[model samples]
Target: MNPAPSHPYRAAALLAMLSQALFCFRLSMPTKLMFDEVHYVPAARHLIALSGPVNIEHPLLAKEIIAGGILLLGDNSLGWRFFSTLAGTATVLGVFAILWLMLGRVRPAVFGALFALFNGTVFIQARIAMLDGYMAAFTVLGIAALLWAMRAESSGTAWSRWVLGSVLLGLAVAAKWIAAPFVAYAAIAFVAVRLNDARREGRSIYAALNARPIGGIHRHWPGMAAIPAILVLGTVSIAAYFATFAPAFFYTVQPMTLAKLLPFQMQMYGQQTQVLPHHPYQSAWWTWPMMVRPIWYLYERVDGAQRGVLLVGNPAVLWGGLVAVAGCLYGWWRTRAPALLAAVGLWLGSYVIWAIIPKSLGFFYYYYLPSIFLCVALAVSLDHFARGTRWDTRFLLLVLALFALFYPVLSAMPLWGPNAFHFWTWFPSWV
Candidate 1:
């Protein structure tokens, strides 16, 4: 491990930003929207025109972002993708900062940032107009802020951290519904932290929990100032959301436009719940852990030449990540530390919800956000090993190199046109 410098964190943040920017820049204008781009780009244009959200199924947050980009860049293909590219870049930097604050080391943070930068899945998503990137960015930021709040013992900055965490969480939820489970996971983690404090103080757990803080708040409250700040952040995000839409949304759209839109959302929700007869590329959750079914968001024949790429994750990273997650579970079981526990909770809680939901049209792409947990877990594992032996450091470097080498093949395949299949697809579901 490198020596911890008096102020090494800023340098690390700059590297993360530069790495992500370069990675995103590689394929920014590669091609038009692949799959869902058709729907999202139009929605963004509508949003820019102050068109009612009548045609859109999701919240206005992502559209608003895309709209901003379009307004500035002009309504071109690149314009629609601008926000996702920015969000993807932000996600890389945020993850690096979070890992640094949580792990208190440079290697783990660098491993995560580099891995995310070269990960085929993350790379492809960053270059498109998709809600997933926005969701990932905000969720990671929220998790990082929450971790900061937990680590801060002093009341002075804790409230501010909590407020930032809450606002980010709210935006994350607004971006995608899947963010709900993360909230539950966070709450559970916080309660556990409270319990730990109570146990240490030799007080009744129940009393310790309910006890208030001194002076400003209830006496005995543990970082009690955070709750109000969190509430304020939440309220503000929600208010900001509605405020953006304003009377223009409700007053402008025709009654039928909204009526039709509401039913479409319900239908989409219904579509999500009802299992399709079968999809050629339908992937099970278990397969995701193994990278068994990678969705090809876009594929095209350039000049009748096959040159497009696949969208699967870096196999080494994804496969190793599975092992890493297991290791994370073991670490949490043995140590009971908040960080390890939070990793496991996030991995399980975010994904397990899909098992119960009756969504009919679930696809492999749905695994995108949850895969981040695996990446972080793998990073944790790599960090552990990197601190152990020279060979371990070599192994980690090998993985990063492999990720970078393979990234081009996957990301550039679509640009290759028809002959892009030079790289073999081992699984039928991959096509």
Candidate 2:
């Protein structure tokens, strides 16, 4: 393994800064609403304008952050997306830290940040104003905290880590409903860590368990004692989730009560079931893994000038991630390594939820969270690939190279119109 710098976060800090510059460079390219910005930016303006929130299906944290940016930047395009850019950059940093915590190595963590930056999933989402970007940042924190909490042998530190993870999970959902999977993820991790701790106390517990039957089970039930900690974790998360809604009550003139809130929630639920009028970009969850389709956020040509932003996976990181994820799953099954297990488990937790979201309408960008997890899974797999060769480092360069190749279309930079669209339209659905 390549030795990491003495300061682990330095590479990540550089990555975050670079990503911010990249996302913010042409901040007003289309100079108008781009993709989902139509729904979110107005809601943010509403927060400041004393207008009612227009988009309530999603939670309020992302809009609140965007509103802060708008308040500072004067209700323009840059203002609309400023906070999203920050959240996206933070996603890169958080990915790095999560890898650092998981691998305890500098090089792999750096690989994670670079992979996420060039992957185009997080970067595209980050550049635009959207709920998913905020969710991505908080998801990174939740996963990192869960891993740290799992690793803690000290009870107090473990509880604190769990609490932090719980609160972050709550905040993640506050940014978007899709992030609810993280809460389930933390609970699963907590149970696995405690059970593993119990089993490790002694191998003879197996024999003891075999012979003693109910008593043996009783004797090994220390894992159950951690229930209070689990309860506290749940409480903290719920409290944090409620706290995110306080602004909805305070900022608006209308008083929020259960009478008003209940129907509002049902209205949000109703929106989920409406697939309506056929969106060109929407796809099933299974297709996202294969990069079958991409959503077009914007396409504009005014007075012989052209600019566009396409939300598509950069094949370098996205496809490479699939191979790496397979490596992680296979290696974990073969070696029973805790680190591999953690990566695989986390990837599954974030991804599996999509299969059951109950939303009739979904898009390529919904894969954003899983795609970021893929980068981490790839980072973990690097430990195995890097041990005996330099091939893994070469792969990192190739990922960057691919990102460079796609930079123009990805960033909405001008090019010969047909060539630009043709280069990006590798598949029929992508148009």
Candidate 3:
């Protein structure tokens, strides 16, 4: 009934454009660095001047992106944060692209983007100059590319997609070291594919002992080379990581080599143990899903008015996703849907990563990445209901309503007093 069903390009574009406009609502505010912006904005400034590194533990690629923003927009809050503005907006588009690819419908494609865009974490993180937003942007793009590659009908098309995805994956990790786990996910995914292929072809495990030729064990995987796919992913990712270090080359000779790299790694590893001044808003990872506490990225009372940035997920989306994930698990068990499995796998895997990390390093913000996938999981559940456009559209409107209600606090809009914050702060811990 709408844009040609052959492609929902117009709907996707409308969704992305509108979301970008919301994220760009106040491209310049506070006129000063917020929490981690203090770490990254200065690094970008230092980068522009060709000075030594500032936030070295995290790679400089994303900072370089910020620096490019500075170069293009002039060294104001907007300039320092311009690329982040772009990254944050692009993340919405990336999520939309992935959803469109998976669901292949206009309603879910637009609603999925809306779900993620309104996600308090995605909304807030994308607007600022922190690595989390950029990391998320690259990751979704990488995933979109990988999924596109898998759908390719020809080897050439598939290889191109893999190359693009690998580079994006490397760029994703370079933005934040925390994303390194995704690389492991990539490798593990390759192994899982081969194992599944063997299972489908009825290959026997006894072949290892009997030297029986694994008839289907070595069958060529569609769209990607079997064993070598892992090598390609690893190699391209490492290359992508080093390429972001290009700015380092200008500042230090042999900066990308193992000689300088190993020492930097050791220093970064050592610095992780150093104590930092305590933050009042810091929260444990387990408490994040419930949003028991929110870390304030910015807080100030100006002339009897209050404006602050509190990193918290949207209540409806977060609470609903919590329930929808169960539906995902149930659906995966029932239908063996690959998309369902991928969504559930990523949602659970991202949360499970926090448990293994030392509590000292874990925070509610670490939950941000997984929360993006949770939106996907939620969208998957909605699509499964087969309720058609009427129900899903209304649900999307409800999500947008929440975003509108929370936008004042999400953007730290000036309020006569702290009273407005209280309206949205459902939990005492949120204060």
| lDDT per residue as tens, model 1, 241-299 | 44434423443454234345446547546544555688766777766777777776656
315-383, model 2: which lDDT tens digit per residue? Answer: 977787888888988998897776777777767777778888777767888889889988888889887
After superposition of all CA atoms, the RMSD between model 2 and the true structure is 4.4
What TM-scores do the predictions have? 0.85, 0.89, 0.90
Candidate 1 Cα errors over 4 Å, as ranges:
1-8, 210-222, 225-251, 255-279, 303-305, 413-417, 422-424
Winner by lDDT between candidate 3 and candidate 1: 3
Residue range with the least summed lDDT across 10 consecutive positions in model 2:
215-224
Off by over 4 Å in 3: 1-6, 201-223, 252-258, 273-277, 302-305
Ranking by TM-score: 3, 2, 1
> Looking at model 3, which ten-residue stretch has the lowest summed lDDT?
208-217
Error of 3 at 74 (Å): 1.3
Residue-level error in angstroms, candidate 1, position 342:
2.4
